[model samples]
Target: MPILPPQQRTDPHPDRTGVRQAEAALVEHYPRLVRLAYVVLPPSLGRHRRVLAAHAVVQRALPAAGSRVRVPRVPAQSRRSGAPQGAEPAPEGAGAEQGPSGAAYGWMRLRVLRAALAHERRPRWWPGRLPAPAALRPAVPVVWGLRLFPRAGGVDELALDRALSTVDGAVRAAFALQLLEGLDASGARELLAGAAVADPGDAVRRAARLGRPDRAGARAMLWSGEFDPCTVQTRPSDLLRRRHRVRAVAAAAALCVVAGGLAFAVDAGTRPADDGRGPAGVAAPALDPARLLRTSPDRWADTSRVDFTAWPARGGRTDDNALLGRALRAWAEPPESVRVSTTPGTAAVPPAEPPQLLFADEVDGAAVVLFHDHADRVVRYAEPLSGSGGAALDFARTDDADVTTGAAVVVSRTADAARFLLAPWIAESTTRDLLAPDTPGRPLEVDPDGVTAAVPRPGAGGACDAWPVIQLRSSERIVEKHAFLLTDLGEPAPTHLTYMPKPGRGTPARQPREATGPDALLAWARTACSLRALAGSGVRSVNNWAFAEQKLPEGGASADWVCTRADTWRGPGRVLVQFLAPAASPAAPAAVVADREDTALCSKFGQHVLAATHWRAGSGRWYVLGAGSRAVTGIRATGAVRGAAGGPTLAVRAPRDADVELTGSLSEGGTLTAVH
Candidate 1:
């Protein structure tokens, strides 16, 4: 390219060819721009900060890179900063050459760059005005350190990748392009083929391609999961795992996204449509389960997002997985826009369907229906719940204390003149049950709240039934069964428990202190169920659950626990048993036991169930109703919600206690063979 003198040039915007000086400027300042970016970062951040700041500035500069504007001509005889055009008249009086993303920084640009860098914590410049060149002159040493030895001021590939893990796809792409591939915005997009991004290029095709059946990659990209921004890691499962909304896009658009490689996705949603009717492809936006919940308007909004799908049963009660539901209700948001299919007579409430049977409490007149399921016992989770595939079972309140004694999830369907309450129960009858060879840790006694806490084996209590004792620390003197559970993940060892004591031990106390601190909570549950000693043996798949509620007794209240335990197999199975000390006061640890049984009842398997109800003051619903593996066990109430039209909707949610397994041969008459 031939160089032109300041006065000899016709237009200042072209490269050496006089085509348009805009692009030439970008290329000329490319290295300087990257360096300038590093300069504008906080010095305290030292090196890594330089990389991050550089990344952001360049990305912001990308969209503005192709712009063109008028420039004042500088005398060719002068330095790169050029002599002030105002001081020396143009030979032809033509304007000075211009550049892409041109700021008023020629030689003074260095000072302005340095100033911007120094003031990085707050870098804002007026339109067109650039920072003082003198400012950057002072940063020359830092600049030298960065370039010559390059002491970590430039983009460290590893660090950049790590940082992008938490950032959004667009920002991530932008960083990847400029930092990784060293491509400009135009170059990057050309590389990414309009990725399912906000600024995707060549819109219409990209939009259409998003939902296209054959494009697996596009689908994956569309369902981007929420990532903690500070972390910068990409979550591949975000998209697919979300409540999926269906929409489609074309292959051409998808191709663009794949090619653009970066910022092109930013312009994605803005493309023109084929029908020239609607917008480009409709973007299937992913909802942030965390943030949305945090930003909910109602004070009592749900505070978390629970993938209850994980611990379906008791592996179950430790945490409240209903936070997301609470948040949705807090924000007056529905889990699913519509839960019911339009039948012949029902009116359609587009985009808002209450599950045919859900617990909706009206807030300021708006319906806040959040449904949560509490099982009587923990068992193999072979199915999903609360959504489409889930059946809604609404229960009317009754004042019962025993979970096994009351009705469980009885749904009533009304016909022309009759209504029937459906249940999984047969006539109540007591019969000989079975169990498996015993191991360690007395089967948990359901706690006061229908749960049991497994305090430390006590180094004291002796090694847990040999499987492997997982130890945990706690603040109480007792142990419960439900406080711990056995799973096949990781090292199959007995993980210990941590329990806090009930309040009011010293002064005349009010209500029992919350059974928090993992151990104490476990103990509270353990106190309910009784635990019988198990002989030598490792038990197979088994589950348990309990429900707890206060019973009006002498001076205060009483506690009860119902346990439902069962194995997840079909052949010959063993049984494990445990319970709390009935004679123990409101504040003692429960006991446990395991046994082997014959002729399996429902598929040779071991299982347990526990439930309870708060005996209504007048209706008199007493007895902790519960059942286990076709065997109805005793029970108690967990919690309650206000019911509809009738009375309070009592939640006879089951157990909070731990689990136990037995290891021994079936032919053995359940001998208490000490493993040691």
Candidate 2:
């Protein structure tokens, strides 16, 4: 038989009543606090870690033995004994004089939430150093504890868990608080905002959709088992020893490096020249055919290679033609100086073998050639032409070597006989749509070899109206092509185009669908309403009082609602819908609207309103009433408003004392009417 240790005795400390009260609160609320912790702690932390974190939170918040307990604030009872005007009466069972316990409970809950959020943000270093209490379980399994009813048929627990896992931590927390704790979106946002959650409203909305569970079941399954009171069993002495060991090691390492020298040394002799050319006598590597074709002219040159040809001509009009001329000149020059070899006494050196031709084609009167030299460089040369040119002035090259084997060419046979060759890698099977609607020339043929041209006969518009024939000379043959007529070609060409590599075969992920137009927005509102109903949330009209009061843009569409029953777990829900017509669709009206609703049984007090109206065309005017004496400034209409025969005017009126402000474009030129 083992000898028993002396019995432990409580200290005879002051504030015994406070200690007992704190103990009583802890005993009653510990389980709920643990549940909150399970939801708030990062899901990445295992069940044991979550339980440990929850216990730590409670230990930090609850009053310690022999500690002073502060009294909680309680609302004063009415002196007259009857309910005051516009004030709600206390419940029948409620005491006339209540202790601070209610307020203390709220504070404790908040403290637990705050502590959980802190743990989520900065997890403990040694989460599993101490064993977790067996009674605690992860909140996920008991998430149903917050639900009013069991999951509906076809609701998979595993799937729900996966969906929750996909949501961001902050969003999950906000969603859990709203769904499990009955917090409104605004309240959740406030709590999370203090913890530095970005876009709390957005997070809440995302969570609401992702966390929705089927609602076809009856009573929820209650968690059984007695929960043990949270107790702190952290070994501070062991932690202190570890900290001391780490500090000693760090100090020793610091001492060892105190007199160390810098590891790197500068060597000017080893540095490359400012021009980036290799050292003297080092021959540049032979250009690989693939590499040369993919390299851009600018990358090959150290300095700007803009001064090779005189085709642009000084004082020439600064237009696409001039730019194309400059580009052609740059392509003709090489970055490295060409090495010449000859007998010491010979005065003449044979011209280097004509560049090995890779491909050739003719556009208008210009001859385009793609060729490479032994120096491992490729050049695109456009032969000088006499006629006016009509080709678009854009150029593109492929940076990828793997796909640079092919070439593309665009040809026009219309009055504007234009032709151009694309870089090899950019070129593929010829039949690509190279001309935009506004492009000067009409496409005749596109092929990998190069574009052929169709010559134009003389027409009324002088030589400019007539398409010319372009002659191209290849090693084996001379090719002739007709060119497009060159006229009205002074406008700047569109920027170059790039083709991204195709993605590998796989099912693409689905993105959340958003409503873009008025019709779509209304439809979205209906769908959201349906979803709310399915989750047992009552349906309300999309155009309710909150919506009718705001000055939405003319022809614009918007949808807003609150989703309380968004998930199986009962919670307050809120949604905001705002839409604007595409900026490119000027004729379309731009509209915005903001609406708020609480789906919970107990309604929350507050309203959010946002609205904007499309501007009217012409010199029209409008006025806003019911929004105090604020002036309605008019905005200029952009793009045509579709179907507004004479540019319709607008008028709006609201209560003179309503708390509303107009933003964005306002309608103009309409009768001032009161909004009744």
Candidate 3:
């Protein structure tokens, strides 16, 4: 063999660590190694399979005795004081790796990384031969019948997961090194290079572009169970199939098997039912259709509670056992083909118990069922009547729902229209175009099933030319009947619209009124486009208030100062203060003065709001104008310009682009800050 190139030194030496050393390292760092593999594994395998595969990769990474590979020292501090389980290990300064334990840890880490990267590689195909079995098939480290997954995380976790899914495996490895191993860019790059990444530098650069959070944030998210495979929630997979398997075993044993097999059959049969409860010793949470919580039809009339708890289960298909069973099964373990959607920050998980049935009816051409978890979420499941495999599920947060916010729900939606299911107490329903303020509302037809006729959707054509809003009037007598408007923001539940009129002096701000009539509709038409930002954002209601009206200095049209606030179900509300010039076109966007969050201004609890902007008048003169709510007794401007007003509004003649700090003296004797 011609010399063999002088015993090539480029190749790595065989691992020489003893089995006891490797075992010791693995025992101490099992969770950390599994987390690294979990983050590197492709998410396309789904959470359950990825979890099992991650554990397998780490276990297989243990090298046989008598192997040698030079690696970074594991650091004395790590052995002396290791990170807790489900936590990222801290990086340490370079030093001598004193023991076989340190080398074993590094060796195991590299093996896990290589195995993960190899798991993602595409197998080479040979002509006329079947493809080789996947290196790490999902079934390899299988636990029969159980689906395991990490605990759910908030929107940030969801966002990071989604962002990682879009990139390649090498970049994921780089990120895992940084996120799970506390490695710097250089350190990660070195590991990737050792793992044979095509371009380690490129992978590290791409990983940095993932909008990775700072060190603290990354550690906090990594600490969550979403990234840890060791700790997981377990649920039975394919309940229907499991039930059939149990029955088949029982039958086979009844025929040809002996007493031992018969005993096995009995144990299997008595394990757990589809409803998660067994025959005699059952104690699991109920998931059966018969166990669904229902309320009386007239419960809303007798109960003072105006939320979804008072809503009765009324629909044509409520008694359809086949449909109800399918709905329940889908909720438990939805098929991969089922279209699942959820609002921001909503956890996508199976119900812990049978949810309260809200509605189950046929609308348009599909069968729809709605459920309330009796907690934070309202879920909707729909399937086509003509069964073309078109099934959809949607989830929206409704923990903050009240009478007005819970009045109606979008039962069905078409390509360009939506049908609402009105509440039992709703006596009348109609549609009005916010753009056409003077036009009378058209009556909306409701079927016997309480599903309204299809109404044209706003911004359907990708333009804000027409904004259709639904007006619902309660049945509690004319004088006491309250009418509110609801607009669909791409969710099953529409957002409640309200209005607060300008407050009078010496009077606290009044409770918000139902957003109806010409004035309210006109104010909304100019600001409806802004609602797009809150679409699918778990908004419960939105309120628009006329805080102040100010006269312009050079005989210009009076401008209306309105504050629009959108309250969400899970987080702080959005606030926008706009200055609308009268001469602006109907579709013209308002001149925004301030946009903020979590402010008490324009809300019933807090009445004071102030904003200022530099504007050019009709006469071409520039002035700094400040407007505040009625509670403001005086307004003053400082910084780039100085001016003062005794009342709640101020117009100071100043140059263009002048910056000013605004402060207001409240009637209640405290200083009020501007919204900005």
Candidate 4:
């Protein structure tokens, strides 16, 4: 492909593209556009914030309903050379010729650049009512309790990033267009002008002075996870400050309410604190054990719903008022002595109405009470049988649960074991080691209350010797008869595990079979231990999909690329892409190429995934190997040992730690960059 002259004539009023067309373009080229915005945004905002702000800009770039967006068309010369007349200009950086996604990609890129550049400006009162700067305003998709920053690179990326930060946003934008968008010097200037830059020529000149890196070095610095905002690592966000702020606001609110009422004192001679209410107080649910909502033991048999709503209240301690009252009071307002904890994304507030009593039992010599709130939260209150002051309250989010996932809850967890309270539909419980697929499942002793005896927990003491999963059998007619798998992830509720057949296996997306059989057990063994990363992240279910397999170069056996996605009860989810080598140890960690949140890649909805890793051949030579899902029609590598193939696999001989960029061409005429 020849490089044509830069497109001139920054069309002030470009041709309009339909909303649907722009949306298609946005979805197809999402990562590229986001990278564009991330590079253009000012570094002062910080990497994590810049990443979130970049995503926000791209997501909000879609044209409004019933409105068409102005998108620039390819220059006349390019159209005459090859691209069709009236077609939208292809993104110079995206490596695609004119296509349906080209026009929309251009429009979205323009919008992202404008928003990112404008974000650097500050609102001024004297500037004829200038709009508030985007930097001063908050960006959407905020994450609490986690600091998300992009993956860091070596000294080269750090130096370049620091250098770029020193320049103005316009110059940074011009530089990024050339490096990331694959734009020529003149093309960068022209695009910057189209984005409404005041001095495009000056910006381009300043950018040029930085000295462009070689093709391999530029791709290594730009295309690597270094500047990709979508992929990030999470750290705890100021734990002490967050706690202090929460306590301060709560204390202030309480003080204001009490002070106001006392100061006014006009309410019918100041009514008593209790009025006519019981000792539990008006702020909490009725304290009496009889007031607790309980369903019949057989309610699950006839109900149309198979969720937690159908779980019957069980255990011999249901009539114990003293224990029940303590549980109820602790839930409403836990004392400082009572340790309270909530999974990520779970609200820490009390229930608005009376909660459904799922279990009030004595398990492992402790009085445990489980309540299901209408807000999709499951709360567990536990107190020692010795009447000691030690009590614990735990909250977990469990929204949108069905029989397969909501069938069991961890009632008690000891040092080396955990006990589960199975649902009414569960007939038998057993445990199996995923690593040893040939071994039979061991039976678990379940008491009459549906609470199982202590089963050995896997991943104890941070060692992945064995990965244990509970195999549940359902006896009820309403519930599915197939057995399912559940694993404890250090939470009150166990995360459900499902398996997706490899692509082209004639398996439907929605019907992910239970993680059973030798094949699934083997596949899961490679990734089950990885669940430790999601222990307290409020994950609801994890689905494992063998997305791709490629024959290794140099007479090595084939390798598999498995994607394990943990979908949280909260909307956001996390994905892990692993490269599993043949005959590797079950306890050996998979080579993770991509691990990030809020992405649809390798998911049931988005079946496409691209990843690369350096592997040594049997002959001891180094090679850069890449693989993609079945939908990928071809794979290509550039910079430092070029390679191209007609299928989903690519292998090129290179240095041991070469800086290579991998991109995949999809059957639908779209392209995808390697997972960051």
Q: What is the C-alpha lDDT of each candidate?
A: 0.26, 0.32, 0.72, 0.74
Model 1, 1-676: lDDT tens per residue? 9987777545433322211222344356555445444423432222333444443343333212233333333334442333223222111111122222222223222222333333332333322122333323223222211211132111122222222222333443333333322344454343233222445344223223222222333222212221111222221222322223222235446745665664455577655433211112212121122211111122112211211211111112213335333433322222443232211111221112111112222222122222222211111111123334532212111111111112111111111111111111211211110111122233322222211222222111342321222211111222122222322111111111122232222343122122223433344344322222211112222333332223333223443332323321111233333333244333344433333452122121111122222232223443222222112222122233212111111223223331212122112122111111
Candidate No. with top lDDT: 4
For model 4, what is the error of residue 504's alpha carbon versus the real structure, in angstroms, after optimal superposition? Answer: 2.5
* Model 3 accuracy (lDDT, Cα): 0.72
The 10-residue segment with the lowest total lDDT in model 2: 490-499
Tell me the spans in candidate 3 whose CA falls farther than 4 Å from its real position: 1-285, 387-389, 460-462, 477-479, 584-588
Better of 1 and 4 by TM-score: 4
Model 3 RMSD vs true structure: 13.9
Clashing pairs in 4: 93-181
> Model 3: number of clashes?
6
Deviation from native of the Cα of residue 386 in model 2, angstroms? 70
Across 407-484, the per-residue lDDT of candidate 4 in tens digits comes to: 999899887899999998888789988777778999988888899988778774557778788999887586556789
**Global lDDT of model 1:** 0.26
lDDT of 2: 0.32
The residue-level lDDT of candidate 3 at 85 comes to 20
- Local accuracy of candidate 2 as per-residue lDDT tens digits, 421-466: 4332221122111111112333444343333333332232432212
